[model samples]
Target: MKYQIRHRTHYRYTQPLRSAVQTLCLTPRHTDTQHVHHWQLQSPTPLQPQTDAWGNHSHVLAVGAGARMLQCEATGMVETLGTPLQSDPLGPDPRLYLMPSALARADDALRRSALAAVRGVEGRQAQALALTALVAECVRYQPGRTNANTTAAEAWLGGVGVCQDQAHVLVAACRAVGLPARYVSGYFHARGGPELASHAWAQVCLDPAERRWLGLDVTHGCVVDERHVQIAVGPDYAACAPVRGVRSGGGGEQLTVSVEIIPQD
Candidate 1:
């Protein structure tokens, strides 16, 4: 499947930024399973986009005017090649170590929740899919409610989180249960779907016959379809991001983001 995306962002400042520095994570990344056919960003100032120390492509834009309007527009097409391997119980990949924080409590509420979802599932693939269903049934995929800083504990307890938060919790829970899991930031075009909103999910690697990374969207409670566009994969949230940056322009006083994702039928 091929998907075309159009994204627009507008920022209205309460006060003229004096001088502002803004970081953008709006760029859709291209990968083996994804391609960027066309892309653009329209801003009030020139964009000094560069690969950051972290190696993710970043957009660093500075506004000369104190108060100004910032707009970002981007369009691209990506294809899902279907993963080379999915749900491999025993692949050549190394074992994934879990973070202590992600598994701090052996009987934490969230761990219990994930276990309940896969009680009867013997293999990692089936268990991961079951957990995805649990998350989707447990929470709603609403944006603007949570952010990158939102804690996994809060999201799990609240039963509500944006895509990022949900992915974080799902991955953490998987790790907590001795499964190797990573976070994925990408775009998902549902079946006969519109260009998808900014989306994130998790991939778990369980040893046995299933060493392949299996994609699961707890936020949507479904396995990946053609709509999934993977940007990067990493052990945690900070890694595998499309874009990230620092603010040298006096913190910018304020910031806002607007994104419009449309899929070409």
Candidate 2:
């Protein structure tokens, strides 16, 4: 499956900004499942491109003073292999994903729940599926109940969150049980609407020795397929956020994001 994606982020500030620097993880990743044809990133200022520790394509955008607004756009065309599971023979050390991160850390209760979910699960893939089902039951897909800063424990306790929270819970749960997992940020081609087009999921390392990973969408309780586009991946959302930034002076800001994923024949 092929897709043309466009993502735009806009910021409006009441007061002009003195100086601002932003880290962008908007570029889609090239993997065994996907191929990038052409990609472009546009910003008011120049974008410095580099690869992060996780091997993600990243950019640093800096804006000078006297700017009341900022806008950034990323457009690209990618082709996905439509494979439900991924096998990365050249992936980074699987142990890196074993460690817990800030947003995806599991608590005692979460660990116990994870253990219970996979108590008798036969294989790694089966255990991962059980964990995915557990997350779906534990966290209801309700937006506005949690934000980006919400942790896996908090979301599990609240019993409501969006895709990000669900991903965090799945990642935390897998890690709690000694299974390696990481958060994946990307675009989902949903027919319902664009509300969930900007999606997230968990990639559990089924076999570290073989570098095998299974992508699970906890929100939907299924394995990832052609509809999912691979973007930056890391321990959690903070590491793979599309845009993260800091500004010297920007009083009261409003942000708006638009994402479009169109299927191509």
**Per-model TM-score versus the true fold:** 0.71, 0.96
Q: Count the backbone clashes (under 3 Å) in each candidate.
A: 17, 0
Model 2 lDDT, residue 7, Cα: 94
Give the CA lDDT, 0 to 100, for residue 205 in model 2. 93
Residue-wise C-alpha lDDT for candidate 2, range 173-203, written one tens digit per residue = 9999889999999988865555445899999
Model 2 gets an lDDT of 0.90
**Consecutive 10-residue window with the lowest summed lDDT within model 2:** 188-197
Model 2, residue 153: what's the lDDT? 96
Worst 10 residues of 1 by lDDT: 88-97
Across residues 87-186, which tens digit of lDDT does each residue of candidate 1 receive? Answer: 4322234254355343122238888887777787888777777777776777667767776767667777777878887787777777777777777777
Q: Output the TM-score of candidate 1.
A: 0.71
